[model samples]
Target: MPRPLPDDLLKLPHRRDVPFAKLTTLGVGGTCRWLFEPTTEGEVQSFVRACVREGLPYKVLGGGSNLVVLDDIEIPVLRLALPKEVIREGTRLSAPASYGHIRLSQDAAKAGLAGLEFAAGIPGTTGGALRMNAGAYGRELVDVLQTFRFLTPEGELVEKRPEPGEFRYRWSFLTGGHVALGYTVALAEGDAEAIAATVAVNMEKRGTSQPLSKRNAGCIFKNPTGSSAGRLIDQAGLKGFRIGDAEVSPEHANFLVNHGHATAAEFAELMATVREKVRAVHGVELEPEVEIWR
Candidate 1:
């Protein structure tokens, strides 16, 4: 039997047997046993503290845009329901980790901020973006990150600036029990109209080059060295390949899409086949960019 949760954690808004297919962008997976949604920082802090004190492990879920859940998760899961609020102090902008990543960019543009244009086309939430050091169009979360607050493995809150070797290409030091609470971005003042225009261009680029019409968990594989992952997969003649309902996106080879009625197992198998084919044809190993939850 599983250990009982503290009253504080149990009191928070939650549901049982929530489907990952409904929670995640991929729209497939088994159910989450316990789904806790804390709407305030204090509640989140309490949740983290309770987990630590009870010797319980938990998973933090953001927008679920970059995750692949393979099976029903029996452990407790926390997905922040904090109010969507953005605070601005001159060039610095602060937002809850639960805030939408793409909406945050739009908010910045509305406030005449320039540095967040790279995030215009990014999916997921700010916390996941920070955890993965998510980047696009030559800029990353680290470039504009000023400071962030996260709970340590012991449930102690810590706030600090980006440190050396802490962030890298599509990766960060925020693994394990660390849970990002909120973060601030250091942006530049620019014409609001121009900022919006830049965002539009980025969004348009994504629509053109990506299979936004189908269900996808963003990029399936990370770029290798100097070359692009999509280009390599396309050159390997793996585009439009399918296994069950999972298919290598014809528009973008690095993306695997679900044409509805797809299962997580099929998606996993399709990815494996694509990787094997890419390796055989290009002699390059592809690393997954999306997180796989088992």
Candidate 2:
């Protein structure tokens, strides 16, 4: 059994049987045991400290775009949503792990910063992006990351600056029990008109190639070396396949969408099917990009 939660943490506004469907882009999930939305960096650290002190199991949530929480399991959910005071300075931006990446990208663009244009279409937060080294169009977070602040499971705050090559394709060292406080991302200067134009072009391309309006995670699987996951799935004839309300998106075979009211179980099943088919047809294994909670 999990340990009891700290008194201070319990006093916060925590909801029981909280529906995760509304929190996720997929719009499907069961109820969570507890949920807390901390609106400040200090609050995030304190809450994490409390959970650690009490030895309670907790899961950190960000924009909810790349997660699939199982409905049948019961677990505590903590959302570290820092306040809007989190700002992007000249070439550096600091934001809570729970803050949205799209908002950050737009703010940076408006500020005339040029390094994060690749993140304009990502639907997560600074913390999540750092954890996954989220990137697009040949640009990655590691390329712009200056440093990061994280709260250890022991409740201590530490700043980390990884050396070059510490981060690899779609992977980072921040996936452990540490909770991110915020980070300073370096950006270059560019004309606002040029930045806006670039953003527009990227958004248009994403809309044409992805199922942005659908209830789906941006990419279900990571692309393998010199190849794309969507191409592999398409070649395997897995497009338009369905398992319950979950379906392999015909628009992008790598995306699995919730047609109406998909369940986590159904989504998992569909992913397995796609993986099997792709592997059998192409002799390559597909890896999930989205995090699954069971």
Alpha-carbon deviation at 212 in model 2, angstroms: 1.1
Pull out the clashing pairs in model 1: none
The runs of at least 3 residues in candidate 1 whose Cα sits more than 4 Å from the true structure, single-residue gaps closed, are: 1-7
Candidate 2: segments with Cα more than 4 A from true spot? 1-4
On TM-score, the leading prediction is 1
Tens digits of lDDT, candidate 2, 78-173 = 777676555656678777676778888998889888888999999877888877888999999889888888887777888878787668888876
lDDT of 1 by residue, 98-176 (tens): 9999999988999999999999888899999999999998899999999999988777889999998999998888888
lDDT of 2: 0.81
What does candidate 1 score on TM?
0.96
- Per-prediction TM-score: 0.96, 0.93
